[model samples]
Target: MSVFETGQTVVRRDVHRSGRVWSEQALRVVADTSEVLVAACVHGAEARWPALYAKARDDGDRSVRTEAFEAMAAGEWELAAAVWQETDLLLWKPPATWFSVNAFFVPEGDGRRLRNWYVNFEHPAHRTEAGFDTFDLTVDLVVTPDLTRWEWKDEDDYAHVRRLGIVSDTEPGPWTPPATRCWR
Candidate 1:
């Protein structure tokens, strides 16, 4: 149970890093910690985490937006057939198969590494209000070097959903998919 402060270096807890690292990576590592809800800001951090989904109310930094988008994109049912057709593959390993809009990424070596700040969308579920007309959906952000795969690992890995509270029906892409959950 190690706690990460704002200034500490960030490497995967599952993957260790050397002594020194990038300031952005360090920030991202701490940003990625569940300690802070990089997605919708309802999450807890030693300092503070604002409501990332509170578009009108949320005033969090870049990281918050990125996490929210990833958590929101997983189960878009109405247009699951079409939207799922365009989704990228999962990101994390087993137990944490994350899905969401490409939402862009930060460059890292030959790969596109995401900066912690931009990992979550500034908005929750990253769905445009218009998306609702088409489907009962939940978007998952799938950031990867290659964007040509689709799959699922866990049904409950969408832990961010629990924190996101409720999405407006007025918003496009219905809250839950027509099905239990979607997979392609």
Candidate 2:
């Protein structure tokens, strides 16, 4: 029998990026069977600097490491320094049909945990035999975990992409409220 059933609420005990069960979090099973298990609201932390450095050194994406190295060479050590120490927890919900939400938890030093929450609104995930994939929608909402303050991130980039016909303006209004409620 399959471990999970369709429409069942379960916790993901695996890392989405690495496909290793490093931790677990409550999620709703959108589709589950012997072949594959697709879920929503799975959350986990990603090692920031190490992954970036590795990607830059090994993977095709060199921008992250390049920026860090350039910053370090220019004597702007702070920019590159934090990229090595800080981690980010991503609260992700793979959409059933409409859109997906990714809320990032950034770390703050000095014994204060009042870090930033970066919410990315994106397209609904496409699950394949290998895994899942999703594209960024350009615009994003940035808010604290407490929701006391909020703003928009990458408006210019979003507009540019829209102008290029890469993505359309779709409201991610439905996802945020529940996330805020759950975090509180």
Candidate 3:
């Protein structure tokens, strides 16, 4: 049996900018098996972005790009790239605790093929009666379809959150380190 059945409704609850509980029927399960569960967003899919940042990336405008970088340095997350993401979702379970790879497709402009692959490694999902849910663990990897270059995003954020007692340092599974000998 699959973790979630096809056409099942999945809700994602998050805090909105107004500080209220905002819940949306985010995903509908498409395919499910022991290894992976695929879903698609039911809501209207569009590329949302800050206007200046979108101009920066899409128009090759250096001035806007500089402004966006400055805004990001000032700790604004919403000022990043204009993401035209595909609706399909792939959740892969790799037999590790608090670890799964969520993959998504982002289309590039030329109409050749979808060129961007975004993979997120985060806590293993909890399968609910409706669907499944998982929280992001901060570390993520993005790559091109040709595998020429890849970027590791948010290592500093992970370390900062860990230091602030937000996330645990303990390994997710049963494995532990052996005792170290002190040689002074």
Per-prediction TM-score: 0.23, 0.43, 0.54
Clashes of each: 38, 0, 0
Candidate 1 vs 2: which has more TM-score: 2
- Model 1 weakest 10-residue run by lDDT: 77-86
lDDT of 3 at 34: 72
Query: How should the candidates be ordered by lDDT, best one leading?
Result: 3, 2, 1
Model 2: colliding residue pairs: none
lDDT of each: 0.27, 0.45, 0.49
Candidates 2 and 3: which is better by lDDT? 3
What lDDT score goes with residue 123 in model 2?
48
Q: Which stretches of candidate 2 lie over 4 Å from their true place?
A: 1-85, 97-99, 107-114, 169-184
TM-score of 1: 0.23
Candidate 3 vs. true structure, TM-score: 0.54
Error of 3 at 13 (Å): 5.9
Estimate, for each residue in 64-117, the C-alpha lDDT of model 3 and write its tens digit.
745543443344435232344443444455433465445554444643354445
